[model samples]
Target: MKSSPQLPPGTCDCHTHVFLDEAKFPLWAARRYTPPPASIEALTALHDRLGVERVVIVQPSVYGSDNAATLHALRTLGQGRARGVAVIDDHTSDAELAAMADAGIRGVRVNLEVDGERDAQKATQWLRRTVERVAPLGWHVQLYASLSLLGACADMLGSLPVPLVFDHYAGAQAQLGLQQEGLAEVLKLVESGCAYVKLSAPYRCASPDALQSQEPLTRLLIDRNPDRMLWGSDWPHPQPGARPNASDVCPPFEVDLGKTLNALASWAPDAATLRKILVDNPRRLYGFDA
Candidate 1:
């Protein structure tokens, strides 16, 4: 087996998901795809093997707005080692939000991909309301949307009251390289100090050859703002239609975790910059204590 990369102390995998006992935390009936249960025990083992000391458990789309699984995972992985980003709507009560804040939820996720195309007016309204709700708590908004939608919402995104985190390379389309529509807007956000982006799931956005094409874009983003960058494994990659059966517990899907880590490492100008991306940046954004 290829050896895991040696990461700095307090290195954080800023993005991951844990799907525990299905009977206890069932998938949303309207979910676009079903994922195999990736229990907290399995995630911990992966982290230990990868030499990752901290993590951020993001609420996956399959669970919709029900953050029970994400909350349970965070409590189980306590000791200030794990934080969470929940999926919530305008109806979510202030009491529930306060409770989640105490439980280590530091942000709210707005995933536009789940329902596909949406009316621009309604989407903007939802974004505004959600941001207003989370801003006072000093929480950020983690956005998972398509490039087109990102472009459409760029102005509002830049104006939000809290920090913005764009997921999966800002949903850039691989085939277009740096010329991808909406990418410039995202880069501008980073340049203006209005946003952060996750260097993760390259496979989701780029093909093997296209992955090489991403080098320039990756380097540019790192150079533009290393402090605004974060890394994640996107573990157990849940592809569309990948449903898990309750009868069998299969081996986890195969992904070259080491390779992903190395690719992100290559973009760093030096050891210090790498530490900033893997450790310092996450600490600041996720509010991890020194």
Candidate 2:
């Protein structure tokens, strides 16, 4: 068998999803896309091969507010090595939230891009209420909104009681380059320790060339607040639909773990910084013990 890339002990993949046994955990009827099953076993093997010791299973939009699949995966992966981010609405009860916390879920996700303006008002209300509910649990809010939406919600996001984690570079458009709308506000959040940005799935937001070209932005974020940064594989990369207004489509779903690691290594100036990105930052964010 091929060897996994060497990484610091306690390295964590801060974002990933486990779509398993759809028969048991069916997709939401209103889901935008149906992804192939990427089971717990597959995720474990992938993480093991990447030399990652811990993972965070983000609840995909396909499951809507039903986090059974994510919760099940967390249990299968074992609480000691796994944490989760779930999707919830105001209808979710405190007992349910308590159960999720016991099952290793430490955060909630809000996908504005998927919800759209038709539901925007309700989604915003849900977000505010959810934030209030989870604040007492010491849980962060994970968001998958576009740059424009992010900029529009900047003030409210900045005022969130818990930490805010922006998934996939806050969905910045590659064609826009460093001048991407709302990026400046995102940088401010990072600078102020009010947010975290995951350096994951560059393909989702930027073409390979654009990603390479935007090294300065990446470096600026890292340099500005290394402590508020995190990394993830976005493994079994889910393709919900064609990116809106993006001239280039995302590459194939296959994730090259080594290449991802190499890119991260290239972005970091030294081993210590790399360790922080791979280990320390995630440890702090996800409550992974040293």
Candidate 3:
């Protein structure tokens, strides 16, 4: 096995999650799949092996808007080493938001793809509402949707007061490279500093043979603006399994995150840029100390 890269000090895995103790923190009834016990210990071990020092534990869709499990993990890891992105709704209280902010929650997640939502109108509405709520708190809205949906809502992006974050390389079409449908809009956001992208979870999106395109995709992103790029282990690497309301619990993908970081090493043009993705960019975005 190839060893993981020795990342710079203060390197942060910009995205990851922890799901454990189901009796205390049950999965959402409407979730598409049941994830295994991705507890904080497992996450810490994975990051330690990968040479990552900090993490952003994003609230998985299975947890819905509860934010409890994610917040618990963030609190366990503590604000200094961990930050979070929660899932909230209109009914979420300002008190709760303040508590989350204190717990180091820097953003909110809108994972429409997990909901199998394709309508851009609904997505646009979601975007508007979520962004408006989080804007005053200086938090960004992190999104996961089809590229088509992104393009449909791209026009309104500039008016938002806070930065937007698109995870998983903004839904790369591996065979399509920069020509991926709707990529132009997302790339423009990255270039103009209106948005950020997380280089995570390629195994969830592309076939192995087509993984070559990630290099060019990363190159284009860097050429546009390296400062907006981030890298993540996406630890335990959850994949959608049998639909929710089913009896099956899907085990997480056995991704060697060391390899994932190595892939990132190749994507970046040099040592300086890789440090930006693994360290500086996350510090700026997640409000981590320098």
Candidate 4:
């Protein structure tokens, strides 16, 4: 394994996942992918070695609504240094939400892909209710949804009391170029200042699957709003079960962590601007110490 790169002081990794150790919590039957062991101890050491001062443990889709692993990871990391985004359903009670707040979970994830909408209306209603429930805790709603639905949900998102965060560069179609309507809608969201967007996962968003091609959209998003943007390493990328091609079995491409840091220059401000992405912005969004 590569030695973790040293991060700037006060840096924060705003996106990373924690998977339940099978020995402790067995896999969910509906999980679409099997994640490798990503324990709290392992994650902390990654931060220490990388020089990241804080982290946000986002709930991976593999766990669905089972946030025990995420919560446990938070407890292990302790308050001030760590926070989390949980997967939740409409039936998640207020007490449960309150307890999550206490446990340093400042966000909830709505995984539209896994939740598959037989009826889009029903799914929308469920999501709306969830947003209302967590509003009091000052928690943002983290979305992993199709870009096509962004405009349709714009009105609903504006009604939300807390900020909304979109993952994977707003799931844009890299082949279609930035003119893609989905990317435009994402820009509109940021233009209005109602949402925060992650500049992580360029590898997941690029055309021909090249990180360099992703810089244009990254530039656009940062240009739109520097304050609301953040960056992360989707650490230990779960190797896709089915190979896209021959390279599937080969070693995956290295995440150019510095490229993300340097994107602050192309997209928005300089390293100081990048500093907010690593430090202040997350502290405000996830309630970590500044």
**Per-model TM-score on C-alpha atoms:** 0.93, 0.91, 0.95, 0.87
lDDT of 2: 0.82
Candidate 3 wrong stretches, greater than 4 Å: 208-210, 242-245
What is the per-residue lDDT of model 3 for residues 51-145, given as tens digits with 9 covering 90 to 100?
78999999988877899999899879888899999999989999999999999999999998877788888888888989878999999999988
* lDDT: worst 10-residue window of model 1: 241-250
Off by more than 4 A, model 1: 208-211, 242-253
Pick out the ten consecutive residues of candidate 4 with the lowest summed lDDT.
244-253
Clashes of each: 0, 0, 0, 0
**Mind giving the per-residue lDDT tens digits that candidate 4 earns over 177-288?**
8787666767878888888888777777763236567767777787788788887777655544444442223233456555554544455557677766777788788887
Ranking by TM-score: 3, 1, 2, 4
Q: Estimate the lDDT of model 1.
A: 0.83
* lDDT score for residue 99 of model 3: 92
Better of 2 and 4 by lDDT: 2
Considering only N, C-alpha and C atoms within 3 Å, which residue pairs clash in candidate 4? none
Model 2: CA > 4 A from native: 1-5, 116-124, 208-211, 242-252
RMSD of 4: 3.6
